[model samples]
Target: MKRFFIGLTIVIILGLFVGTGYFLYQKSEEPPIIYETDTPFKTDIIKKTIATGSIVPRKEVALKSQVSGVVEKLYLEEGAQVKIGDLVAKIKIIPNVVALNNAQAQLQTAKINFDNSEKELKRQKELFDEKVISEFDYNQFLLDFNLRKQEVEAAENNLELIKEGSSQKTGNVSNLVRSTVNGMILDIPVKEGTFIIESNTFNEGTSIASVADMSEMIFEGKVDESEVGKINVGMDLSLSVGAIEGVIFNAKLEFISPKGESDEGAIKFDIKAAVDLKEEYFLRAGYSATADIILQKASDVLAIKESNLIFEGDDIFVEVRTGEQQFERRQVKTGLSDGINIQIAEGLTEEEVIKKL
Candidate 1:
C-alpha cells in the first residue's frame, strides 16, 4: 500500500510540473507588430504662424471738454451712431468767484467811462452847433464817445460769458459738445453732474466720449520677433475673433513696426492689418482676435505627415515599406511645411507606402 501511494504522489508532481511548463511556453509567444502605413497624396500645404491681437478702429477720436464744467446733459449714449457736427454732450460751466467778480467790475468801470464820454460828446456837439467849436473837434469827441460805448458792450458780454457757460452773443454753441468726425460712439466715461476739467497747459483734460468709424476697422496685433522678420507689409491674413465664432475675416497687412517691444520676456513687433468689414456683421472695437499669417504655400503638391520623416543628422529620411512588414530608409528632399504635413520635393513616389513610425 505504501509503494502504491509513493507512485501516485510522483505522478501528481510530474503532471503539475508539465502543466506549468506549457503555460510558460504559451505566454512567451506575442503577436507580431503589423506596422501601419500611409501613402503620399496631393494637397495644399501652407506654412503659417499665429499672432495674438485685438480688432480696433483705424480712425478713433477721443472727444474732450474745452471748458471746466459739469456734464449737464448727454445727447448720445454708447453705441449711438453720429455724423459730423452732431451734438454729443452739453457742459454747464461752473464759474469761479474771482473771475466773475473781475468781469463784473470791468463791466461797471466801462459803463462809468461811457457815461462821462457821452456827457463830453453832448457838450462838444452843442458847442459845434453854436459855432463855438470846429467841426473836426466835435467829430473827434463823438468818435471817443462811440468807442467808449462799444467797450462797455464788449465788457458786458465778457461778464455774461464768465457768469454763464453760454452767452447771448455766442448762443448755445459754446456749451453744446459736437462730434468732430462721423462715427459711432464707443464710450462715454462721464455721466450727468460729473465735474470735468478743460484741456489746458496743465492737463490733458477729461475725455467725455470716444467715437470711431466702424466701417473701417483694423486688426492690431503683435508677433514674436523671430517671426516678424519673415512677414512683410501687404501680406494677406486670415483672422478669427474669439467672441464671434466659426467665421474667418480677410485682411491685408498694412503696417509693421520697425522697433520691437518686450512683452512678458518675449520681444514682439506690432503689426496692423486693414480688416475688410462685412455690412452684415459689425465688428466692435477691441475684439480679441488671432491672425494666421501665411509665410509660404504650395498647392497640389505631394506631401506626407511630418511625423513619418525621421531626422538623420542634417538630412531628413523616411521609412518606405518595400514588402510585407518590411521598410527601407529613403532620403527625401523637402519644401514648405505647415508644421503638420510637409511637402515631399524629391526622392519619393506617391505610389510608395511609408511606415507611420
Candidate 2:
C-alpha cells in the first residue's frame, strides 16, 4: 500500500509541472499589431484666426445738454426710435443770481432812457413843423430816438434768455435737448430733477441720452499682434453673437489699427468690419460677439487627417500602406490646416492609402 501511494504522488507532481510550462509558453507569445489605414480625399481646409469683441452701430451719438439746468421731462425712453431734430428731453433753467440781476438792471435803465428820447423827439418834431429848426437837425434827433428804442428791445431779449434759456426773437429753446441724428435711443442716463452741465469748450458736459443708427451695424474686435499681419482690409469675416443663437452674420473688414495696444502682457490690434445686417434680426448695440477671420483657404484639395502626420526635425512625413499590415514612411508637403484636416500640397495622392497614426 505504501509503494502504491508514493507512485500516485509522483504522477501528480509531473502533471503540475507540465501545466506550469504550458502557461509560461502562452504568456511569452504576443498578438500581431494590425494598423488602421486612411486615404487622402478632396476637402475644403480653411485656416483662420479668432477675434473676440462686440457689435455696435457704425454711427453713435451722445445727446448732451446745450445749457446747464435740471432735467424736467424726458420725451423718449430707451429703445425708442427718433428722427433728426426730435425732442429728447427738457431742462429747467436754474438762473444765476448775478447774471439775472444784471440783465434786469440793464432792462430798467434802457426803458428810462427810451422814455426821455421819445419826449425829446416829440418836441423836435413840433419845432421842425414851425420852421424853427433845420431839416438836418430834426433828422439827427430822430436817429437818436430810434437808437434808444433798439437798445430797450435788446435789453429785454437778454433778460428773457437769462431766465428761460430762450428769447422771443429766437424760436428755438436752448434747454430743449434734441436728437442730432436719426436713430434709436440706446440709453437715458439721467432722471427727473438731475442736474446736468452744458457742453462747452471747457467741459464735455453731461450726456442726457445715447442714440445709435441700429440699421447700420459694425463689428469692433481685437486680434492678437501675432495674427494681425496675416489679415488686411476687404477680407471677409463670420460673426457669432452671444445673445443670438444659431445665427451667423457676415461682415467685411474696413479698418485695421496701425498701432498695437498691450493688454495683460500681450499686444492686440483693433479691427473694424462693416456688418451686413438682416431685416429679420435686430442687433442691439454692445452685443458680445466672436469673429472667425480666415487667414488662408484651400478648396477641393487633397487632404489627410492631421493625426496621420509625423514630424522629424524640419521634415514632415506620413506612413504609406504598401501591403497588408505593412507601412513605409514617405515625406509629404503640407499647406493650410484647420487644425483637424491638413492640405496635402504635394507628395501624396488620393489613390494611395496612408496609415492612421
Best by lDDT: 2
The most accurate candidate by TM-score is 1
lDDT value, residue 221 of candidate 1: 95
Q: What number of backbone clashes does candidate 1 have, counting pairs of residues 3 or more apart or in separate chains?
A: 0
TM-score of each: 0.94, 0.93
Q: lDDT tens digits, residues 276-340, model 1?
A: 88777889898999999988889999999998999979999999988999999999999989888
Error of 1 at 67 (Å): 1.9
By TM-score, how accurate is candidate 2? 0.93
Cα deviation of 204, candidate 2, in Å: 1.8
Runs in model 1 lying further than 4 Å from the true structure: 1-7, 29-31, 170-172
lDDT of 2 by residue, 35-154 (tens): 889999999988999999999999999999888989999988999999999999999999889998999999999999999999999999999999999999999999999999999999
Q: Scored by CA lDDT, what does every candidate get?
A: 0.91, 0.94
lDDT of 2 at 228: 97
